[model samples]
Target: ADRPLLHGVSLRAAAGQTIAIVGQTGSGKSSLAQLVNRSYDASAGRVLVDGVDVRDWSLDALRSQIGKIEQDIFLFSRTIAENIAFGKPQAPRAEIEQAARDAQAHDFICEQKDGYDTVVGERGVTLSGGQRQRIALARAFLSNPRILILDDATSAIDSATEDDIQRALRRVQRGRTTILITHRLAQIRWADTIVVLDKGRVVAAGGHAELLRSSVHYRRIFSRFDAALPPAEPALAAA
Candidate 1:
């Protein structure tokens, strides 16, 4: 059967709000993301940005405003600075450095023999997985997209490094809309709204406590964090 990948699915995020999406491996999370940036068009329905459907926008005009940090980070055989500045090719040195610092990549970048000028191997093979992700994050920070998509962006970083990056994520996420897909309870805890998907549909959506109390689907997906969440608000729990 050629059923739609996503049906009756809708998500809305106020400008500068963070929306976290969580589901099992094939719950259409990434499909929903691809639609937003038009990596592939939806077979039906629409993805809107600023009340305008994405298909109505030009690729360059649309994509320049979106930043993405995925689990698989790709880099060319170029200087570290060039890779970070890939999107904004003419980014000033100071801005690039600041972005790197925010991504917690600056110290390691400076430690290289050529510092920012170090030429990484093809696809950043010279860098460790965590380093690659931080560099990808630095690129996103430098681009300063109005809509940021972080799909398992911190998976490669260690717990301690992740803590630093999490603080940075909290700080930099201000003033932009963020679409997050991650399993880390730490990052998911702070989202303005959490949308829970199941079998390609949105099964539930709400704050951590609300979902913990109300959504069986969400609870199963995030049961490990149940003890850590604050109890649901009395009124919300009663709903």
Candidate 2:
């Protein structure tokens, strides 16, 4: 049975803001993302983007207007340049390189023996997981859509690299709505609003601190993250 992935979940993301969806596995985070892009029509509610029903928008135009990065990155059998060009077929090579640099992919890309001309192996297996994800991000950046959705796109990346990707995403998200879907609380600390899901329903919605102090589920998850952080170093003694 196709269960309802979201139930009465009402939230908002204003222009130039970031909205993050955090929850445990099978808790509907990815479903909400797909719902927003109308990949799967809602069972009983509406999914709106920029004041318009997603279902009402023309399919090709709708997809082009919203950039999405999934956990599993997919690349074509063509050259890396062609894959990056897939987002905006007419995008100039300079623009593609700029986006790759922004994604922190240019250095590694150029280091490849074939450089931009390297053919991405089937499903991009020729590249590392992080490389493929960065390429995916570069493609999204090149699209320059009004909205961006990243569904656990950083799961395969290490913490330091994740931080770098977050920085890059911040620059790209300016003046655009960004939806980050993940189960990691640390990933949503910068979100304008964090929506917590449980049993396919919204159990909390607020900024990180507000939820940490007021929402039980949020507190529990945040406590786990807090515990994982390295202990602060003692202040250096005056010499």
Candidate 3:
């Protein structure tokens, strides 16, 4: 009763589809996603992953089954290859390369003097933000999990690069359930379902068009995006 971050929030992420959660800061969107992997223990109800309560699953197994991409991507002080291979240490070199390629990282990676062997500076300081995100994505791709949680994962990349990243993501998302948490309506306008949260409760949930036409919460959020968008790229407004 005290914990209402996800109050009566009943939503489903069908297999092979993407679900996005939109909300203002502190609306508990992150809290809800964290519940999926038990990042933070829920104070109230259970979080089910693959039909089993997340608390009931082995921590390692549950984590490995879900790929979480944070807003701020963190990389270690190691060669690019090693960083991407961090998740699946035993993964073959070919698989590593394929993952980078799938993440649309191979092209830029090849430009590095040492290619995949290039040593990342402290905290990956040697790379650009977009490059870092791609590497992080490659790391996730290496795991090949059943579920993907992207927490504003593409916020730093340019629109063009974001498109490439989304394309790569589209390819990998087949048959995998995805939970995309973002404030940008443009990023999630195409999600299979959109859940809107306000003040730590589910205010509205439905397909983008459905909410756009019916939910006041959805309309307010869309207006925020409309104000954020550039006139030339009103395409993001289609949400």
Which number leads on TM-score? 1
Which model, 1 or 3, shows the larger TM-score?
1
Report lDDT (CA) for all predictions. 0.87, 0.82, 0.83
Maximum-lDDT candidate: 1
Q: Write the per-residue lDDT of candidate 2 for residues 1-239, one digit (tens) a residue.
A: 86676788888788878999887778888888888777888878788777889889988889988898888888999899999889788988899999999988898899998999999889998887788888888998898888899898877776657776777767777788899886565568888999989878999998887776667777666556567733434445789
- Model 3 over residues 1-239: C-alpha lDDT tens digits? 46556676777777788989998778888888888888788777777876888888999999988988887888898899999998899999899999999999999999998999999998888998889989888988899889999887888887668778888767666778989888666668878888889887888888877777767777776677678632332223544
> Distance (Å) between predicted and true CA of 27, model 1?
0.4
* Clash pairs, model 1 backbone: none
- Superposed by TM-score, candidate 3 places the C-alpha of residue 195 at a distance from the truth, in angstroms, of 0.7
| Candidate 2 residue runs with Cα over 4 Å from true position | 229-239
Residue-level lDDT of model 1, residues 95-164, one tens digit each, is: 9999999888999999999999999999989998888988888898899999999898888887667777
TM-score of 3: 0.90
TM-score of each: 0.92, 0.90, 0.90
| Clashing pairs for predicted structure model 2, backbone only | none
Alpha-carbon runs more than 4 Å astray in model 1 = 224-239
